[model samples]
Target: MAAAARLAVAGHRVTVYERTRTYGGAVGRLERDGFAFDTGPGLLHLPAVYRDLFVKTGKEPLERCVGLTQVDPASRHVFADGTAVSLPNASRAGIVSALDTALGGGAGERWGAFLNRARDAWDRSRRPLLEEPLPADVRPFARDPYPALRTGLLRRPAVTLADVGRRELRDPRLAALLESHALAYGFDPATAPAAAAVLPYMEQTFGSWYVSGGIRALADAVYERCRARKVEFVFGTAVTGVLVEDGRAVGVELDDRETVEADHVVAGAPLPALYREQVLEWESTDEWPRHQQAVRTGRVTVCLALRGAREAGAVHRTVVHSTDREDELDSLARGRLSERPTVVVLRPDDERLRPDGDHESVTVTATVAAGGAWASGNLWGAAGGPAVEAFADRMVEAAAAAVPGLRERLLWRVVRTPADTFRETGVFQVPGPALAGAGGSLLPAANPAPPGGLYFAGGWSHPGGGLAHAGMSGALVAGLIVEGAGFRGSQ
Candidate 1:
């Protein structure tokens, strides 16, 4: 929608071909028995990306299209030792104080010092790594941009995020907190570069936000804005292949054998899907970027609809850390379910999500391996297999720490596996955070394909995943389309 809106405002006749009958690819809403749930991305961060898109596309800004509220005390974390801390939104001092009160006296100081270093990483990488296009010579960014700290008697400096947590934070709980930031995005902290610290820094500095109804509301607003800008949308029409002529994409061929001709094609489909559908073919396997070939993770979310009213003072988001971080990461890396996986529980106080003030809507999510047994079609339905049900039960149990009387809430639940996600969005492999080493092995494929006039957008392309990054991808694609290859970035 962002790309379409921008192209339309640029005086180009834009037409969006959507396979599903929805505007948002993964961003969707599930309504059942008068309760609403956001199926993807419960929280929004780095909202300025969208704000800039709205301002550049039209006279009305993003605030006019959708209602956004900053989530205060951004999230509460519950460790395995039963220690809990509620972090304030965008307040370094408040977070330090909260950690001090909850964990110990020096715990907050350690975390504060870590954040200070993380701020340096964010400052160094924000523009080159995010706002602008991936440079042809990415070796500068392939090297870790995080600043190193001096420690007495330590010959070797800490390079990985896990190393920083163990050496600097010292406390197991603090280490878990640092690792959770990477884990939440489906990155293995042990292997993740020290630059991964930017994840927590970005969240803590910019703060987390939620649309009034749900994230789907933001998607709806983007869709409506595109419509207002006169962008044509063809829903329920699947693109089968890209029309290539003279080694360049001229248009797309749909499932119905209808060819939609265009000068350029902006493909939001997953790269794997494009290859599978024969839309894109390389001369050799080596042509594909190594980073784009990295393993991708998926999510398993369970939505609960309760009959009773939400308790007062309930935190909007709570992360229950795993008992064994190493085991969890190892299991995820091996494409297996973790025995004690980290779970994120969300309970929005908004009345729009429930039938009335008496009802409560909660969503519990855990990261899982993509395209495994868990992603099988049979496990997507309400009556999942025994193993799937057992995993859901475990996730619910973990989330019980946030919601009192969770099992007794007396309402049914909906389980959405990676298969369902793949069916809806066409991207079975959930993109993870771009890593900071191995010659750009962490990043996604470049936006511009080898074939001229063929461009890629969304999480599967450059700049990597997350709602904010996806939005930025749309902006980048638009810039490339309007200004050609010389396009630097959004002005």
Candidate 2:
């Protein structure tokens, strides 16, 4: 919708072909008995991307379109050892103070120093990695950006985010604090490049934001913006494949054996559907982007239609770190279900999400394997199967620390596993944002890919996923379309 709106504003007649009868792809919402919950992303980061979209496309700014709130104490982290810390929203000094008081032993200074290095990484890659088109020679971005601190005698460069954690943070709890940021995005800190530090840097710097009703509200606003710009939407019809003519994409072939001719086709669909349908293909296996791998991790969202009222002092977001980190990561790696998965608990203090002040909506989520028997089919109405239900039960248990009496207050719960994600969005995995380093192993496919006129927007494309990165991808696609080959990116 963001891309459609931008293209429409540029005087191009835009038509969005949606597979489902909705606008938002992954940014979906669930409603039951007046209780509402965001089934996709719980919060928004780098909101400036959408703010820019609204500014460029319409007279009404983002502020006027929807309500935005900066979550105070940004997020609370509950480590395995029962140590917890509340990092203030976009306040570096406050975060340092809180970490010192919570974790102790110069932990604050270490994290602060890491942030300083992370800032350098952000500065080095911001223009090329983001806010611009995917460069042809991605050599610069193929290297680590996070400046590794020299430590013990047997020192080596911090190759992964985990290395950065252990070498620098030094405390298990503090290391958990750092790794939680990466895990939230479904990145294995063990393999995610040190450039992955930019993830936390972005959230900590830009501050975590929330849409009034849910993150879904932002999608609604963007969709409305597209409609206002006269962009067309063909819902309930799937684009089976991109129609290629003379080595260039000219239009798309609908699933109904219908052909829609156009100058360009922006495929925002997941890669599995894209490749399976042969919409976009590379003759050589090496021709594909290095980072666009088969991501196995998918999210499990449990929406609790609780009976009790939300407390005035409830934190918006909380991360309950897994007690056994090794087991958790190992399970995800081997496609096995973890006994104890790290859970993210969201307890928004919004009257709109509940029937009244007496009711509250809480969302609990965790990452899990998405392939094979794990995400075979839709598990929503399966009488709460053993695997999903048991996993959800663990998630709810972990979330109880954040939302007191979580299980007791639950009037009803709806669980959306990887299968549901695959069913709804056509892919089980939730893509993380593109990052620099690991020899471009962390980067997503370029926007202006082979066989011109077929641009890949959304998470599966150049900028990767997340609300902000998805918006950036939309902007990049718009830029490529509007300016043709010379679209360097917004200045």
Candidate 3:
């Protein structure tokens, strides 16, 4: 949708072909018996990205299209040892005080100092890593951008996120807190660079927000904005292949044996799917970069419908940390389910999500191996398939610490596994954080492929996954298409 809007606004005729009947690829809504749940992301961060899109495209701003509410006490953390802390949104002092009260004496001071270092990293890499198109020569960014502190001849300077946590935080709970930020996005802190510390820093500096309705409303607004800009959308239509001739993409061929020719193509579909199904016999080895084939992770979400109303002053988001971090990462690396997984519980107080004020809607999510052993058959209904259910049960049990009497809520539940995500989006694995390594393997494929006239967007492309990154991907592709290879970035 972002690509479509930008292209249309640039005075180019734009058309979007969607395989699903509805718009919003990953951000979707689930409605059952008057209960509404956001099937994808539950919270919104770095909303400035979408705000910029609306300002550039139309007369009205994003706020006019979708009602956004900042989630105060942004999120609560429940440690395995049963320590709970509610962190106020965008308030470093409040967070420090809260941590001190909940955990120990110096925990707050340690975290505050760490955030200062993280801020430096964010300032250094913000433009190059995010707003701008990746430079052709990525060797400059291959090294860590995070500023190192002199610790008086300590063993070795921290490099990865795990090292930073253990060396600086010096408390298990605080270390868990830092690592949880990476784990929530399916990145192993042990391998992810300390530069990734920008994740928590971004959230704390800016705030976390939610739509008045589910997050699907944000998608609805984006789709509506595209439509208003005269972008045409064809639903339930699948493109059979990219019509490539003489080493250039001429257009696309639809399933109905009809071909539409164009000067350029911007593909939002997964790159792997494009190669395997949409592009025929096009054996250009360099067309798809080797780093694009790196393994990606996935997510499993369980939605709960409760009969009771959400209590006032309740935490909108709660992260139940996993007891065993090593085992969790190992399980994901081996394509299996972790015995003890970190669970994120979301409880929105909005009335639109439930039948009435008397009812409540809750969502529990965990990162898992994409297309794990559970993907062979319909795990949702297979008689012998108790693994998924058992995992879901454990997630719920862990979440009980956040939501009181969770099991006794006595309501029906719906589970969406990684297999379900693959079926819906055709992307077998959910894109994880770009690893920090020598050859820029940490980043996604560049916006422009080899040669001319072919571009890529969405999570599979540059800047990687998550709601904000996906939007940036679209903007990057549009910039490349509109301004040609000479384009630098949005700036």
Query: Tens digits of per-residue lDDT for model 1 on 172-214?
Result: 9999999988877877777778888999999999999988999
Ranking by lDDT: 2, 1, 3
What TM-score does candidate 3 reach?
0.94
What local distance difference test score does each model get? 0.84, 0.84, 0.82
Expressed as tens digits, the lDDT of each residue in 353-430 for candidate 2 is 999989998888888766632345433336547878888888888888888887788899998887778788767778
RMSD of 1: 2.3
* Candidate 1 vs 3: which has more TM-score: 1
Residue pairs clashing in model 2 are none
In candidate 3, where is summed lDDT lowest over 10 consecutive residues?
372-381
Q: Candidate 1 local accuracy as lDDT? A: 0.84
Q: Alpha carbon lDDT of residue 340, candidate 3?
A: 92
**How much is 245 displaced in model 2, in angstroms?**
1.4
What does candidate 3's lDDT look like per residue over 222-262, in tens digits? 99999999999999998887787888888988889889998
Stretches off by above 4 angstroms in model 1 are 150-154, 289-291, 371-384
TM-score of each: 0.95, 0.95, 0.94
lDDT of 3 at 18: 86
